[model samples]
Target: MRLVTYRRSIEAEARLGVLVDDLVIDVATLGERAGSPLPSRMLDFIKLGPVAVSELGFLLKEAGGRWPVNGALPLAGVILLAPIPRPDKNVFGIGLNYIDHVAESAAALDTAPDLPKQPVIFSKPPTSVIAPGEPIVHRADITQQLDWEVELAAIIGTTAQRVTRENALSHVFGYTVLIDMSARDCRRAGQWIYSKGQDSYCPMGPCIVTADEIPDPQTLDLWLTVNGVEKQRNNTSHMLFKVDELIADISQGITLEPGDIIATGTPEGVGAGRNPQEWVWPGDVIEAEATGIGKLRHPVVAG
Candidate 1:
């Protein structure tokens, strides 16, 4: 099932719903009719886990036929919000996880930094998150070389620690699209915090598909286009360290709680990798998509 969060109006609070075809079924409305417990918000539904998810699926199936019955509101009238608007913690991101991306960065930096014998991990602040269709603030004054990195993000379903690669995927809730917006200028200064943590830099979700929907995570085709021009194109099969290894590696000591997101990194063809280099400016539109998962589009505006 595809789960979503949306707001009917600016003054309204975010609500939980299920996305079926082009319609959005308000879980609360269905729960009320089905005699199941109603969750106050999207986060509440997430906290309820698989049982709640199953109950929702059953309710929707029972509702049968068409959705958003007459007199009921249509999903088109509501503003689709990020599946998880504000994640509970930082978003884990892997760096240099694709061979081509690694090679490109190595040549661009010309600094041949240690080849991260293991997964090179970093994180983006939770405040940076913006939902699909939202505007990405282009901090013109702070950065002239704003760029984009399209990545595949995995959502954790349950708390986990010291997990083995053999069972790492069992801890995953699902997958979604993550745009790792970056400020190349800030990154050259030393740390990734300023480069990657700018407000509205991280754009994720339209919805979260349960792990079952994607039987194999390794074969998805991921791509990104800027102003209708393709920039990055690659398959998840090229990931230097696959999802299972990544989960096991990250969870070795630290605890991964439900709702925590881990961005599996981008492929080659970033703006910085171009001959003369290309960068995002105010008014530029970015669209990133992954197979099975969905698409995320955001416009660039002055910060």
Candidate 2:
């Protein structure tokens, strides 16, 4: 099942939803009706692990493949929010993990083209995350060079510490599309938090496709576009450090808990790597997608 967090209006509380075709099934109410209540928040729901997932499957089967009119809302009628709207901690990110992206950065930023022996990890504050259809804030006073990176985000379902690479994927709950927005000029002394961690810098969601549906995340296709023009396109197969390696490496000492997200590095063709070097300015729209996860579209707006 494709899971989501959504609200019917600005004043409504965000609720957990399961996508069934073009409809959003209210998971909480559905469970309540089945005499097995479920959490309304995505994070809380994720913490329940496979049992909750199994229950959802049972509920769907019990429904006989049909939902009452009031039980499921039209996908267009709800405001889709970030699956985990506010992570307990910062969002983990991998940098320069795509071979071609590293090469492009070398040419554009005057850096060496050598691939790193280990994964380069970074963090983005929770505030940077925004939902689909939200505006990506462009602070003119702070940055004139805004860039975009289309990445596949992995959400952890179980606690992981010192996990082996072979067993790493079992800890993942699902996958979603995440656009890493950057202020190219804000980097200082090689640190990226200032450039990539500002509010609304992350545009995530459409919905989280459970890991069960995407057995091999590496084979998926992903791409990004600006104002109807394609800019980045590549398969997850091109990633220099795959998802399993990332999860295993990250959990060596630090713990990865439920609802934690890891954004596997983006592929080549970012605005910063273009021949003429483009930037996303106010009024432009960015649309990015990963095969089964779906697309995220956000307008660029002045801060």
Candidate 3:
């Protein structure tokens, strides 16, 4: 069952939704009829543990047939929001997780070591997140160069601390696609905070696909395109530190809670790594896609 966060209007309350076919089921409305009202917010519902997820699975099965369809709407009827619109903490990201990407970045920096000793982790403030189809505001005033990164984002289903690699997969709730928009000029100065923390720097989600559906996260295909031209394309199998290892490594000291997003880094085709160097300009429409998880599109606009 695919889970979502959405609303009918900007001022309308954000509610939990489940996508079945082309329909978005209002879990809260359905729950009310069953006398077991589910939480309106996706994060709150996720905090309820696996039982809630299990119940959602059952709901998805019975939805169109016996369940009330009053609150259900076609996918185009409502506004889709980020799976976790308001993340509890900064979103975690891994840099140079792909071997080819590491080589490219190293070459650009005139450095050595095709691969890093450990995963390079950084944080993107929650406010950087924007919904799919939303505009990724280009920070043109302060940044002369803007870049795009298409990455697969992992969502934590439960609290995890010092988790072993063997048990890390079980802690994952689902997966979503995140476009990690970057300001290359600001990033070259060192700290990735200001470079990546700009408003709408992260365009995330069409919806979250449950982890049960993905037996092996590393085998999926991911791609990104700007305007009508393809830019980045690769499989997750190339990741130096796969999903399980990334989770275990990150949880070694920090506790990962439900709804926490982890972008597993991008592959080698970023614009910044090109021979002549390329950056996105205002009015560019970018689309990022991952097999099974679906696609995310964002339009670039001057800040």
Q: Pick the candidate with the highest lDDT.
A: 2
Candidate 2, residues 179-264, lDDT tens digits: the string is 99989899988888999999999999989999999999999999999999999999999899999999999999789999999999
**Counted clashes in each candidate structure:** 0, 0, 0
**CA-lDDT, candidates in order:** 0.85, 0.93, 0.87
Tens digit of per-residue lDDT, candidate 3, span 200-227: 9989998999888997899999999999
Candidate 3 to truth, TM: 0.96
Looking at model 3, which ten-residue stretch has the lowest summed lDDT?
Answer: 60-69
Model 3 steric clash total: 0
Q: Which stretches of candidate 2 lie over 4 Å from their true place?
A: none
Q: Candidate 1: global Cα-lDDT?
A: 0.85
| Candidate 1 TM-score versus the reference | 0.94
Report the error of model 1 at residue 225, Å: 0.6
On lDDT, the stronger of 1 and 2 is 2
Q: Compute each candidate's TM-score over C-alphas.
A: 0.94, 0.98, 0.96
Give the candidate number with the greatest TM-score. Answer: 2
* Clash pairs detected, candidate 2: none
lDDT value, residue 74 of candidate 1: 63
